[model samples]
Target: MLAEADNGAELAASMAELKAYLRIESDGEDAVLAGLLRSAAALCEQFVGQWLIRRGARETVPADGRWHRLAARPVVAIGAVAAVDDAGAVTPLPVEAYAIDIDASGDGWVRAVRPGNRLAVEYQAGMATDLNGVAEPLRQGIMRLAAEHFVARGDEGAAPPAVVSALWRPWRRMRLS
Candidate 1:
């Protein structure tokens, strides 16, 4: 459970709703939510540094409302998400408000929103950079860092800080109201 707001009170209330809302049915306990979880991990791994650190629930609340909670019930070995900036700074990441989850077989898709904002990175490149043209493996690598770096390589100070997806969100500004 995680939520974002300029004020702590609003975020707390939202977290409560988040926790209650994420329960899975017995059948849902199976593989119903696996792909979405994978995509969430990829999103986290792809936006490291720019989005900073994993999310945190309001201290006033009794539960931990980090974005990783989504993976918690699913028994995902790897969990957590943070967006870092170009300067390599770490700050609390936003909760995942919503995302697109699709069936690989193209059967269907669903839109899901969690409690808080997802880590949004900020990076820039030259005209020839063509970031959109990056290969899928590199994209997955970026997603890997966004999801797993903090626990394994980034903050824990592994021999070599793990590879993270660092980028600038120039066109996309925070819709903070």
Candidate 2:
């Protein structure tokens, strides 16, 4: 199973930024705004197909001597790679036993020196290591989207404005089906 290990402390759009965007001056709606910001960040990630905040993740895959692509983009580092047995036991592989490669587009790839049935790889990936590192357009999109969500609170079915997509389009990863 692959799962995110950490989401980091900084949000793509901070509460203060969102509040300022919405012209909200009171703290009464802080909790609601926080949720909206998180939701907006998540939506941005989904649209871009990348993590906006740096975080760790683990994924298990068949180690068949073929390059296996990591799930997250713009991988920052590979922490560990281990072989997993049918009994669910994990044995860490030596650094020399595998190779890690990241493409120009920031996609990470891994392959074992020797073929094995399965392996688990732990790594970090994201578009930015911190909130400030995120692109301006992405941050702005998050703020705008959250503000839109706040204003349209009861209209969950409404589509996000085209500007959100426009702002995020450049960062969107294109996957060939």
Candidate 3:
């Protein structure tokens, strides 16, 4: 399971930026809009298979030969690796025991030179560290999605808005067969 890292960074979009995009005149619904922005950012992350802001990511994969693929994209850096004992206590694995590759393509790969039964790897992954670093397309996509969610208020639809998908298309991970 790939979970968000507890790095204490804010989401890629702020309430003021979202408010400006949405054209809300008053702060009457700031709290509600804030929640919507978070939820919308999460939905965008799921849709694109990527994190928009810096966050720690921990992935556990059973050893298969000497190499294992990290699930999250645009990995910023690898933090630590550990071997889980049968009792589930984690011992940190030495840096020499593994190798990390963050290639130009943005897909990350890790290899365990000394394979263990189950290896837990911690890393940082995201497209940007903050809102200012986020690409314009992605920021626009988040605003569009949040606005739709705010207006519709949980209405399920046949498909996502074309603009959202289009803006996120380049960042979407392509599945390999």
Please give the lDDT score for candidate 3. 0.77
lDDT by residue (tens digit), candidate 2, 1-177: 779954535763388888888988999999899888888888899899999998889999888899989988878888899998889899999999888888888888999889988889999999887667899999889889989989988986988889999999999996775
The best candidate in terms of lDDT = 2
lDDT string for model 1 (1-177, tens) is 323222222122222222234443344432323332334333532332112122322211112224221211111122233433446454544445323222232111112244422333221111112223333444344334323432352345443224432332221122223
Candidate 2: segments with Cα more than 4 A from true spot:
6-8
Regions of model 3 farther than 4 Å from truth: 6-9, 154-160
Error (Å) of candidate 3 at residue 146 is: 1.2
Number of clashing residue pairs in every model?
29, 0, 1
Model 2 lDDT, full chain set: 0.86
Better of 1 and 3 by TM-score: 3
User: Measured by TM-score, how close is model 3 to the native structure?
Assistant: 0.86
Q: Report the Cα lDDT for residue 27, model 3.
A: 91
RMSD of each: 20.5, 1.5, 2.5
- Cα displacement (angstroms), candidate 1, residue 145, comes to 1.3
TM agreement with the true structure for every prediction: 0.18, 0.94, 0.86
Give the Cα lDDT of each candidate.
Answer: 0.29, 0.86, 0.77
lDDT of 3 by residue, 8-116 (tens): 2375247888888779889998888878777777877888887788777888877554666688877889888887767888888888877778888677777777766
